[model samples]
Target: MQNPAIPPLASEFSDLPATASHGPLRIEYRWVNETAATAPIAVFLHEGLGSIAMWRDWPQTLCERLGMRGLVYSRPGYGLSTPREHDVKWPVDFMTAQARDILPALLDALDIGMQERTRMWVIGHSDGGSIALLYAAQHPDELAGAVAIAPHVFVEDISVESIAQTKQLYETTDLRNKLGRYHADVDSAFYGWNDIWLNPAFRTWSIVGELDTIQQPLLAVQGHDDNYGTMAQIDTIGERVPHAQLVKLDACGHSPHRDAPDALNEAIATFIKSPSKAPTSTPARSPK
Candidate 1:
C-alpha cells in the first residue's frame, strides 16, 4: 500500500484541443520544483493504472534530490484526464500513438520550447517506459536521456496472466473502488488498459525491432523477481542499444520506485548527472 502521509505534488490542468484521432481533452500535469525552471527537466510517465496522484511524491522527491525540474502528468483515459468511451478498447498501437503524437502536442501546448525539449529526460514505468522508448526512437534529437523501469519490449504470457488476475480481483475485491481514488473515470482507465492487453491480437505486440532507433542515453531497470516481466525486457534493449545501462536489483519486485526508491533514485541521479560515464550494473549507481 502507498503511504498517504506524503504530500501531493502540485498540479495544473491544460485543456488540450482535439487531435486528428481523438477529441478535446484536459491533461492533468504537475511541475516539481518549478523554482528550478532553468535546471534539467525530467518527465515522469506513470504506469498503466497510475495517475499523477498514484505517483505519490516520487517525481518531486527525485527532482529535488537531483536539483532538476519534474513534469508529471496523467495521460488521457487515466487519472484526471479525459475518459475513454464505455464500449471502446485501446488500439494495439496505443503506446505508439501516445509517444508519437499525444506527447508532442502536450509539449507544444505547454510552450516548452525546443531548447528545453532537448534538455529533458523521461522517467517511465511499465507502459510509460514503453512510451518513453518509442518517443526516443522517433524524436531522439529532443531528449537528453531516459530511465525505463519494468518497461516492455515485447508481450509475455506472465504479463497477460497477471493482468487477467487483476481483472478478476477488480471485480471480486475493492480494487475498482481503490483505483477510483486516483482516476476521474475508473472504468475508462481500467477497461481501456485491460481489454486491450487481454485482446488476442495484442499478444504479438512488440517494438523490439525499433529499439535500435533510440540514440539518447538509456537506463533500464527491472527486478530479478518481477512477476509481470523478465530480464529480457531490459537485456534485449541493451542489446539493441549498446550504450544502454542496466540495473537488476535483488529482493525487489515490479515497482522498483516504490519497492526500492533509494537505489532507483541514486542510479537515476548518478546517470543524469553524468550519463556518458553511467556504469552498467555498477553498485555505486542504478533503475527499476
Candidate 2:
C-alpha cells in the first residue's frame, strides 16, 4: 500500500537527553506536564507500529481531561528514537526485556521513581498493552492503574494467522509504505514485532498466569471487530486479575484509540479516576 498522505505533526519536544542504556539501545522520552500541582502521570505506550506522532492529540486530550502530566515516547527503533544497527528478530523474552529493562531505564532517565507519590497510570495499546501488563504484574506497587487496549495475554492461532496475513500485505500491498511514515526505520520496527509474534516459539507464550500478580486496578478493552486479536485475550486477563475490568466496544478494531476514540477515552478516564482497592500487605503470586 502507498504511504497514507497524513500530515505529520511538528515534533512536540526537542531531544531531551538520552537516558541510560538497555543492552545496546539508549532510551529517550518526552514528558508533558499541564500543571505544576503534581497530579498522577499517564504514560502512553504506543502500539508495535506506533510512534509519538501516531498518537496525534490523544495523549494531550487525555492528560487535560485528567489534569495530569503525560509521558509519550517511541520504543527503540521506532519514531525518532535510536534504531538497531542490524536486522535482529525480537526474542521470545521480548516482553520481559521491555518490562524489566527498557521501561525502568526510561522512567529513571525521566526522573520518575517507582516510589513517587504521584500515582502512575499506564495506557498501552496492543503490544504496548502486553508490556504494560508485564510491568504492572512485576511492580504492582509502582502503578496506580493500567488500561490495556487489545492486549494479548495468551497466544492464539487467530493472532498468528492475522499476523501472517499482515506480513503478506506488507510485502505485496501498501502496508509497509504506510508504516514507513511513522517509523524512521520501518523494517526494524515492523519485522521486530511481526517476526516475534509469528515465530513458532511465541505460539506457546502466555502471560495470563502473571496477571494474578498484578494488584493495581486494570481495565482491558477490546473491540469486537479487532482483526488481530480476539476478546479472549482480555477475558483471560480479567479471569486471572481480581481487579481487572473488561470493556468490549462493538464494531471496534485493534486500534480502539483510532476506531473508537470517544469510547476508549471515556473508559480510560473512568478507570484511572476510580478508587483503587487498598494495597495488600503481601504481594500476590502468579496463578498456576
Candidate 2 to native Cα RMSD, angstroms: 6.5
| Per-residue lDDT value at 122 in model 2 | 84
State which candidate has the highest lDDT.
1
List the lowest-lDDT window of 10 residues for candidate 1.
1-10
Clash pairs, candidate 1, are 221-288, 267-286
Off by over 4 Å in 1: 1-10, 283-288
**lDDT score for candidate 1 against the true structure:** 0.87
Q: How well does candidate 2 match the true structure in TM-score terms?
A: 0.86
Q: What C-alpha lDDT, on a 0 to 100 scale, does residue 162 get in candidate 1?
A: 96
Question: Candidate 2, 173: how far from true, in Å?
Answer: 1.9
Q: Provide the TM-score for each candidate, comma-separated.
A: 0.94, 0.86
lDDT of 1 by residue, 120-176 (tens): 998899999999999899999999989999999999999999999999999999999
How many clashes (backbone N, Cα, C below 3 Å) per candidate? 2, 3
